[model samples]
Target: MAGNSDPLTPRAKLAVTAGKAVAAASRAAGRGSGSVIGGRVALKLDPDLLARLAQNLDCVLVSATNGKTTTTRLIAEALRAAGPVVSNALGANMPAGITSALAGGSDAKFGVIEVDEKYLAGVARDTDPKCIALLNLSRDQLDRAAETRMLAENWREGLAGSKAVVVANADDPLVVWAASSSPNVIWVAAGQMWKDDAWSCPSCGGVMQRPGDDWFCGECGFRRPTPSWALSGDHVLDPHGSAWPIHLQLPGRANKANAASSAAVAAVFGVPPQVALERMYQVQAVAGRYDVVQFEGRDLRLLLAKNPAGWLETFSLIDPPPTPVILSVNARSADGTDTSWLWDVDYTRLTGHPICVVGDRKLDLAVRLEVANQHFQVCENLDQAVQLCPPGRIEVIANYTAFQDLRRRVGN
Candidate 1:
């Protein structure tokens, strides 16, 4: 066993040990990896366990409505150029999961955490991270999570007095509003695809004027900050005015934006753009997202799109027409119960593709697709969906629970 060197108090130490044991038992029992459950047990014993575990570590928290998991993974990999770093690589961003990850990596020099948007403030308070990356915020899980502006307000209030250096997306007005009050902020011009949520300024409730990639609120004089790091088409422009090409295995503009932000965050940790980009190129998948696996004689590439904003970016990543695409959606608790977000996405873009709909919310998706005039086949399960497609590479886009279910079924 890797021994934890942090000088945790006796109670915290016992809690961590118990948590590790429970996690191990969970793995042995063929249940899910017990990061969450173990952390839950540990927090029950010692509420301060996460803070204690995070002590003496240089931590970075990445939060956004989308791309946080991938961005976290990228930042972690880039930071690996520095030394052994602890991270919640499984996309567990809540307090419990974070506690487990920190407890497990007590000896590490750095911690890179993916934080859920709603919990960013709490996590930041506990971790006291050296850097916080604020990615773009969009309406997501409205049934469960707060609205984008509400989340931004919480973030703005939560980060008001924090000493952590914030790396924020300047193109996203909400993100700008949230991170503006921070003492130290590094602005990055990471593009925002979904604009519906940001048209109204979060600062003064005035209509934002966006002219050629720049946003300004005429009423409050709030405008997009000049970015220290900017993403040009297929390239990253650093503060030094050097343009570095982004050659990532991950697809689409979203990952490129993620990589740009990651490189900026990596620079905060003393890793240069070249080294960070090279390290980031090695990441082929994040938590089974974009994983290509052979299942029943078909090559299935998995993609996750949980909200309208995510779906917009995901559409650009799908292979062109003629490649069969399976879209699975579930309204499980993990996925927000509100299916109305479906209407917000432009499904017409998928008109030319071979589409298959599956999961608990297939009917809802089918109705949306039908209204969009896109033809699709409803399948009972992933197996039927895959069988319905032609033999060769197929694309699988699913929401949270549906993606996990299909991943488990495909044994990836």
Candidate 2:
């Protein structure tokens, strides 16, 4: 059911029911159980329906490894603030996912989608986005993907010949160079101190040199532009990292980049920069990445660390704790299933000690945690980690798949 779910989209099924009422009648007669949780797959689509939906709306797509969900959600919210709009309701990215999201919308003037990199060229050709939000690319899922350069090369080719406007991250010099000098491009980034975790020339194997947190160049002199819109001032104001105060909901240096990316794209629709930022600050983080979860009369900060860049950002957070940490990893093919990604993550950014390692892959994490020379308890299960893990002042870092599992198990 999971693999074959993509064919016969919701619209196609409805069309069948319309033609033969008995089909719908039969469904009404049988009620085993359907769905409410998530993960709906319908591979085959009603092409006409998909085309019609695309034809009827002005589109925007946001794609990236780490910040996609939050940035896409933020952009959709900002666009809604400007006027009426629709979104790919769930976190849908593939063609089928996009098709399903459009199936139920009554009529949306503006459509915002979170697109995956592998499928974006096809989607862009079909949807013809008026503008695109291209966030930074980093090494993720080593088992599934080639080097980050391969992904960057594909995107550059896809965009090179397209007519859409672009909103890109300026600090990511490779993506910025690919986006260079398009009149429709408006670069965006954080204040000057926002240095990147990965900066390299995709074309040549050269380490990128940071001229400033907002600008970088390779030894070969491949330079990137300063942002058209930037946020200044430091001390990060909200130190404890539980959450940034009221207005700008998504917290940390990484989220600041996401907010800036969203605001830049919203401006292409004629929303002023200040107005866009004002709206973005009003938006909140989605569940998982930086999504604060309440448990056992205490707060558990949840972050989905699927890649080295994302994990580094989480580990960088100011953990004012009874200090120790709960860390997890996975090599499950479905969950990027290869722990080799651990080698790529710059765990040195993490300070002091990490106390406990949880999840089925605890030993894999222990190997990485050991490099940090921290006190760690490697357990086979998350429940054990929770039992032994101290309640006060703690940080738990889990990958995409484990984040959900942790929420159900130890996080209670």
Candidate 3:
């Protein structure tokens, strides 16, 4: 057993010990990843394990419907220029996962957390982060997250009293509205490609005016906030109008936007702009999002898309007619039980591309593709689907459980 070097109270130490034991037992039984169960046991024993472990450490919370995992990973990497930083690298965002991270990283000088959308406020309140990065918010897991408007309102109410600086996406109307009440804010012009969830103004329920990339409410005069940090191609424009070049191993404009937000958060901790950008370039993959895995004699690049917004972003990262792509979907609990969001994704974009559908919900996806007149083959077995895909590297886009299954299959 690794010695508990954290300066935890006697009760907290006991709780952490119990949690680690449960985690080890779980792994031994091949139950699963055990990250969540371990944290759950610890929290069950000490209810305030997160708060206790977070003491005396600089913490940053990254919350968004789509980019939470990737953004959190980027921020943690950037913070490495300072010293060792602790983060939940397993894509765990709930209280249990967070407790595990804090307890495990108890001796680390800094913390970066990817918080689930609905649980952001509660976690932020407990951790009392030094900075909170608010990325775009859209309708995700509708069965779990009731309404997008309510979530934004909850953020506004929760962050109104916090003294922490908020690094927010100015292009997202929901984010702009949510961060409006924060005492200290640094808005970044991170582009927004998903706007279906924000057609109306949250303040007046009136139609919003979109002239260019900016938005404004005609009735209540609510508008987009000007950003101090902006992205121009791969270069980041700081508040002083100085451009810092950024290069990332991860592909996609979405990741570039993530880099901009992370750089801004790193600045609050005194990390140089170039140093932050250089460190961000080191992140090749987040969880299994961009992992190139070898499975059954085939090389597949895995991409995760759990909702319409995520699908749009993932699709943008791929070439219009790149290697054959596999689209996988599942209605498991991890993926919301509802599969209606499939219709919300613009399948028309893949009109000329070959798509192989796989997953428990392949039939659901097949129907949607047929409706869009997209030619696709449904292969229930992913290995079989890979066999059908074109030679050379192929792209595999999977949602929640399907993505996780593929990662495990490749021994990731």
Candidate 4:
């Protein structure tokens, strides 16, 4: 439909008719687009339909439980520095979205996409990518996905039967163990790790390494080697909300983790560190991850939390010292049919003493905070929460539905 406006077309009308017909039939078959998938034709097409589009593809696929969107976008930019690239640089990481990206860029030499854990195997099978960057897998979306170990096993299967080279985070026990025996695997070290202690031994299911970030198995003696790229240093945010030279497109160490993961994948595409750093300067933050705003002369930082693991990371980023906050949550089946994961996050990080809570499930957020011995102010609606903010300082945290509610309020 988009290309139909082109001139000098004799059979173009016929081609447009076919495209429209194909798109219409898909909707009738319960495979329509525009909610998660867009433009009925772009997504409803099958593997063979996309198979025809995959030619001369030099792909870099990023898969993980977290940080995929930011890292995928970063790797795409760094790959562009190396040569021509085709990427789903947006946050669209599903199978249909990936197919749409490939169809849109059949001429590109490389394709980079962020993939979900449940879909990694299918995506790898369908796309047959050149390199697959697996970020650390953590517990997330237990309702929609399998257990963390199950996802890792699927990734292991993908790795075993793949032509793609693997670049993985060395600090993570799951990723490090997988990389050790793989003939075509590269280890990318974490610049820093907030979590110093590791859990069960990778070898004998006994207690693993303790003391600092160095990982070692007490049972079978399998250990982590020094990383190729070590964390140089980190800057801490002061009590006054001022931090030192933390120059990144996004906020939080979690994002720095994203930057590091992207830089590692960029290496697979042959992008030099200096060039990657330069591209980093040009890169902008992904819209939903700590997307900032200036409201009533205060800063509004919006973070999308999907699970307990990410919720912990969000807490770590917002460490101590009374800062104004407005947190929101929702219960749409898409955002986990159950909000039970809220019980696991250590939410005391909202140091402002009394965070403003808003949403249909505002009580859920408030109750979670109160149970954790934190304070909060509940509002019936988002606008009331927005109005409750003093004319000075503020920050907003929103989940799927709450995000839409805020957008309606402030046009964000």
Every candidate's lDDT: 0.93, 0.64, 0.88, 0.64
lDDT of candidate 1 over 1-412, digit per residue (tens): 1245656899998999999999999999988999999999999999988888887789999999999999999999999998889999998899999999988775688899999999999999998999999999998887989988999999999999899999999999999999998999999998988899988889889999999998999898999999999999999999999999999999999999999999999999999999999999999999999999999899999999999999999999888999999999999889989999999999998988999999999999999999999989999999999999889999999999999999999998
Error of 4 at 16 (Å): 11
**Candidate 2 wrongly placed segments (more than 4 Å):** 1-43, 181-183, 191-200, 203-207, 214-221, 234-246, 410-412
User: Candidate 3: lDDT of 298?
Assistant: 71
Q: By summed lDDT, which 10 consecutive residues of candidate 2 come out lowest?
A: 31-40
Residue 380 lDDT in candidate 1: 95
Better of 2 and 4 by TM-score: 4
Comparing 1 and 3 on lDDT, the stronger one: 1
Task: Tell how far residue 138 is off in model 2, in angstroms.
Answer: 0.6
Number of residue pairs clashing in candidate 1, backbone atoms closer than 3 angstroms, sequence gap of 3 or more or interchain: 0
Q: How do all the candidates rank in terms of TM-score, highest first?
A: 1, 3, 4, 2
**Cα RMSD (Å) per model?**
2.0, 7.0, 2.5, 6.7
Tens-digit lDDT string for candidate 3 (127-184)? 8899999998898886777689898999999899798899999999898899998999
Q: Please give each candidate's TM-score.
A: 0.97, 0.81, 0.97, 0.83
Model 1: residues with Cα > 4 Å off, grouped in runs: 1-5
Best by TM-score: 1
